[model samples]
Target: MDQEKVNILLVDDQPAKLLAYEVILKDLGENLVIASSGREALEVLLKTEIAVILVDVCMPELDGFELAAMIREHPRFQKTAMIFISAIQVSDIDRLRGYEMGAVDYVPVPVVPEVLRAKIKVFAELYRKTRELERLNHELEDRVRARTAELEASTAKLRESEQRRSMAIAAGKMGSWDWDWISGDWMWDEGQYRIFGVSPEDFEINPANVQARLHPDDVDQLRKAIAEFNKGTRAYETEFRIVRPDGEVRWCVGTAAATMDENGRVVRVSGVTVDITERKRAEERQNLLAREVDHRAKNALALAQSIVRLTRADEVKAYVNAVEGRINALARVHTILSLSSWQGAELSRLIDEELAPYSLGEQIKLAGPEVQLLPATAQTLALALHELFTNSAKYGALSTRAGRLAIDWQVDDELLTLSWEESGGPLVKTPQSRGFGTRSLLASIESQLGGQAQFDWRAEGLLCRLEVPLTRKTAAAAPGKFDTAGSAELQRASG
Candidate 1:
């Protein structure tokens, strides 16, 4: 389709005629091929793509009619425009033959130069336009194929990405939404309807519908947050509570950002929401436990200060020893408390921990059902037990070889009744004065633990009775814990 390089073949037997024809068509701005005979013309046709061929009728071997027939027989040359030039006058039969051979025109010898030039110009222009159209058609076909491939690839990537996003959102218990400010229509994915506890058919995701289900306290706060986001003041991030139709409350956290228009105005808001009710409940419980631990610390400090102030021993060393021993007893009760995550401690283990230093045999007997006491009650009773054991070992039952002590407790109704009595010891006598040991025990049992204790000075032994009120308040069983020792024989669930 190179316009400047279109081929034109000129065939004549005489050298003079060939020169004359070339001179006539030299100004046409096309490559011209000269053939001295029909055979030579066929060779030219084979080598080059010809737009037009002018052949002489009188030739030694192949005439103009024969050349035209050869050109028509080949498919590539079927559309090649052919013109025949005869030097002698043509017969009607010869003219018909030229026409039958696919000749468009027959030029006579002494041909008019202007008419021949005009005819060649017409065919040359037609050739240029035809090649140009063919080129354009090929280019269009290539472009369409490339565009189709691009679209197919883009669609595949989009489908793959959407599948991954849906899986991630479902696993995370999250939902996505889009709000168009101009249309006032909401668009939600499958996850959004599920998180809100609504079926897709019944769900009306509008501003009013959203506000209606929110907790009364959080509605205004969420609105304010969104308003600020629209005003270009802050990024949207907030947590709020939602009330379900069945009257259950759940917490949710939302975050959104705005898409801006060309004029820098808000166009749409897109965001995600997640259910966080369980996490919020856990946080509340942790805060309450922190406060309770702080209260225990303050009370323990006050009790220790009282112990130091009230001890009336004559020697400083004896007083220090007594305080140290009482504090260790309190620490043993604290061990069981930590094991149960500050829930409570078993009563029988507390008894064994206090009496471990003394010989644990028939001389010292203990019997009690498994009772889990509150941390405060355990701490108070641990100090009292320390005093009782020290007294029995020094001057009471355990002071003699045949001495025996029995400590037993039983729960009846809401009261825990405990008794401590000593027998098989030296003749018992009452002390002349009440010491810090007796006072501390009385104060801890009565004031700290909210319980009562009585002492009886009898001839055979000293008897002490304590009654404590049990309440039905506390947490469920602590996780990852086992019952303390000696609980297997006396263990029983609360009745």
Candidate 2:
């Protein structure tokens, strides 16, 4: 790159002296400005940045001292280099006065061209160096600010990551620990202290203190796991129980990894212990449910066998239909029980399900308070209801459009009394012999449910009243609702 030029101002009352000064400084490769008077020179200084100013001592209007003083007083030109040029010999006192007015050098008339060029070149180069240093300082400050901002952002991100890690560990009920096997040194974080149910101030962090809290039966298993880890095993896990100071037992699963030294010895161990008490309890409950389900399945199969064996049918089709109908009734009630987690079934829901096919306008009117029956009671009632509805559709109210079946139930103390009345049907007569359907209904209510079933064969219709003794287990079950889609509305008698 080429060197940049600086401006040098020449101020004289005579044109000849101004031309002489410009010619002498032209070979220095700097910009030279000419002004014929002091007033003209001041105007030039305002427009340009002059590095060196050469003014004549004998001026027509403003003398050298006066002009230099005026230039020095102006803020912009205070640091500008000024040299006085006089045609007459200057006394020492006059030179001192010129220096005080900011004259840097004095050049006598018939000045040496080489000496004047050397002085101006020094001052011009000094100004360029000062400006370059200021620019570099500004750049250094900017870089420092940018680096400081980057460090602050990185620190904030790291803090957020650590906070998230801590929250996850706490939520999972996990604790961490580190031990130096060689030095017998132990270290545990806050989570470890919390898991053991001991405060830091009350408990010492050592193997003896930790072992004292271990359940007697689980200590051996833990010892075996640690022994395996010491024999060059990188990973090992064990499940154990801990008895807290307050005698609360907690299940925990521990997993650890060992660091090996050059001699293949275990030097350090790091691990985590997680509370698994809830998981263990859930597993126990699942096992109990499995056994309960197996027992219930066998009972259902036995009930189906009994229905098939005792059913008296003249044809294969009759036998198949009777068996299928009873089985389907069992399945429907089973579905309801499953939906409620085998807790119980609602009495109203059971009635609605069995009467779904026969429901036509107001052909059936049912009124009952909300009642929940235990699993066994629900199953027996489902079969009984199926037999009643089948018998009605064949010979009773559901056989004709004009006939109607009205069923209602109420609970008083521990007994639930339900009445099934068939009105507007053919004239009723007492049967001499009981069929299998009537026998099955009577057996389910009396033998299985311990309830009484009374039949009234009047001239108009058959009215059956069932007095069922609800055990504490049955009436205490909480009432539940299931989706009985497309079922008729039953009258609910609030109690």
Candidate 3:
């Protein structure tokens, strides 16, 4: 069919006869090879891919029958068709013997060339069809293999996508459920079982089981939400508490929407639930802390006003100004504590917040380890730093444009040491009288933090040093152990 020629082999003992057969088959449009004997024919068959063989019965070493039998024995030539030609009249036994040796047809000598050519043509066409069918079968098999590989790859991608989606839902603490009102069928995601604190196998798709888990006070609210959802008047959105079988109560928020039929009748309900117990508790704690902060701020302002009244002198303006500044500093510390939920404050952040009110130039140097101070310690230190800053601004280093303060702090051997050194100030001398600002600074550091305070007045400038024990209880405890009477005595002596 593809216009490719088929090859035919002719075997005989005489050269003239071989040439005559080749000339007869030349018009048949096939490639023809002529061999003078059975050995020559076999040699030709081995060299070329022959489709049909024509043999002469009488030969020298091997006859046509013997050659046909030999060809059948070889696997490569088993499908080749063989025909025998004889000069003598053939007997029935001779025809049967030729057939047994794999001959398909016999022709007498002086054969009709047209008939012989027609028979060879039939066998050639059959061989061509068999090869074409095999080619088609191989192509079909290759296509099937490619399609199967694509299907396998697609299946793997689908599995990977499902795994990622499931992981995301679990990590977000989201639970989903679907309920069919008509058939009473329910399907819950794995996260739903975890949120309810119930084993998946123990769950029943019934309204009674769901209602049983609700807290006594929350049952009515949950029922109301569900009733409203079923009536089609509203979607289900509610926050309620559920008591687990283990006697632990948890808060959960649930949202549901109904799937309605054409007539607006509810057919299914699908929803998600989330655990919000920890979030609710944190909000409650924040509210309580805010109220406490307000109370403490009021008490601090009252105490400042009392100090101004008791220490007032002929210089009323200066006394009021100093008292107001100190009170404002205390308020700023409280604001920082509130931002941190009263846990603590970063030492550096506290210093920056307190010094923002003063117009100290960038030349004021601060060096320290990064330390977190407790709320009480932050308050005490803020007050002490404010007093020092005020004193320097009025008469010490900060009063002059060229003056500078170098502040440094460190922790060594479980004690915190902070030193403030001033330079470029006028000649320094000890003050004759103890002032409220000086007294407050010494009292807060020594009494509240269980620390020592020392001041040295030198010709160059003033140097203030504080050494505080880095113990947890005295610095952070609600009620500290440092005696107020002893702190007052130390403040008077130091001032």
Candidate 4:
């Protein structure tokens, strides 16, 4: 279907006019030959086959009319198309003379660009069709002499194709079967025996045996499909589950076409059954991920609502800052969880992220074994650490250059014990009442994570101890509600 590009000859005495003609015909994707005079055009025509000629009628010597006459007189260019472009009005007598000189079309002083392109396209396409027909006539005679060899090659290719089809069916885990249900006759290929997990020597080719291998839930559905196929349905498709001999269940899909007799009765059915177990499993995993994402999104929204509801400060800006700080801490935890596929977050990473803004140097020391916290626990602990860091930057060990803080943790007796001690800052004093930060911190360890927190306000600084069970219970409090459930002794220990 791909045609060769033909040559379009643009002839004019003026260089600018020839350049303009080349620009207009460039997009036609044809080979354009430009000539500044009729003599140059004639030389080009003698060297190349021209399909369409655009000639300026007012050339200095051997003008458009004279040039067309000379081209038409040549035996090889007798039928070549010529279009004349004139910069002056042509009288009716001039037009008659131009037609006699082999001009097929003419344009006035100003040409309509679209009209000129349309006229040239028609002649070019006609020339291409004529050339193609001549080439086909030459090829027809040679085709008759090579027909026998082509037939032999086709036979060999068909045999190779059949072998490739069998290999493809096996590689694809697909099996083909033909069943004459009316006569209780069934035949299966090698791939079918593999799919059914049965050996041909031990398996009986019967409908009852096949039915027995189908899952009980899918039996009726497949039977209905077969019934429809037998009742004049030309094609039918169904998906079902099959239980193999070793108690392994697999998913499969069947596509079949019914062969009908002259009386419109289906005599036989043939089709392919493809194993779709892997595809089914992938779909199940995708669905599970969708549900998990939805659940986690709701939980995150609820946690944000809780931070907004529980946060408290004297000024509006203070309250907003408190809420934002806690939410930002929660967001960081979510980021860590996402990076780990929501499996968990490392305890040290969470601590480092919260304390990073404080710019703590050698004055602060940290010692802990690597521990991964669940999503809920990580969120709660991250918020608690953010509160602790905010307090230290404001009044505790990190408040002065001379101040010091040490954090350490260890796992013992199925419990993780983390201690935070501070020194060399303002004198410690216990608060008169528990604030939002203290209440949230207590709730995180006790209610949310099922742990304990004790704060000792010594004269030098503050020391806090937290104890959380390794196999902790799920959080008892829903989001948007920071549970205040704890022992009075623990409440008294809050600073």
Q: For model 4, which pairs clash? A: 306-480
lDDT of 2 by residue, 1-495 (tens): 977788889999998888888889899888899998899999999999898898999998888899999999999888888989989999999999999999989988788898888877877788667667778888988988988888888888889887876786788788899989889898888778888999889999787888899999888876897789777899899889999999999999999999998998999999999988899999989999998898778667767766666666667776677678777887899999999998899989998888777666788899989998888888878877777777777677777898888999999997989999988776667776565566666766776667888887765667889888778344222111111111011111111
Q: Which regions of candidate 1 fall more than 4 Å away from where they truly are?
A: 1-164, 229-234, 472-495
Residue-wise lDDT of candidate 4 within 262-313, one digit each (tens)?
A: 8999888899999999999999999999999988888788878777766656
Give per-residue CA lDDT, model 3, range 1-495, as digits (tens): 346788888899888898889888888888888888888888998889888899999898999899999988889898888889999899999999999999988888788998888888888877777777878889988888988988988989988987886786677667889989799888888888888889778878577888898888888986786677678843678898888889888898988888889988888889898888888899897898788777666555554554455443346575567667666777788888879877877778877876797768774899999877877787777767877877777677777887888999999877789998988876676767666556666666776788888988765678999887666556543322211111121122211
Off by over 4 Å in 2: 1-125, 170-177, 180-204, 212-225, 232-268, 271-312, 315-324, 360-367, 397-434, 446-495
In order, how many clashes per candidate? 0, 0, 0, 1
Ranking by TM-score: 2, 4, 1, 3
**Model 2 superposed RMSD (Cα):** 7.4
Lowest lDDT sum, 10 consecutive residues, model 4, at 484-493
Positional deviation of residue 68's Cα in model 3 after best superposition, in angstroms: 4.2
For candidate 1, the per-residue lDDT at 252 reads 90
Q: List the residue pairs that clash in candidate 1.
A: none
The TM-score between candidate 1 and the true structure equals 0.63
lDDT (Cα, 0-100) at 12 in candidate 2: 94
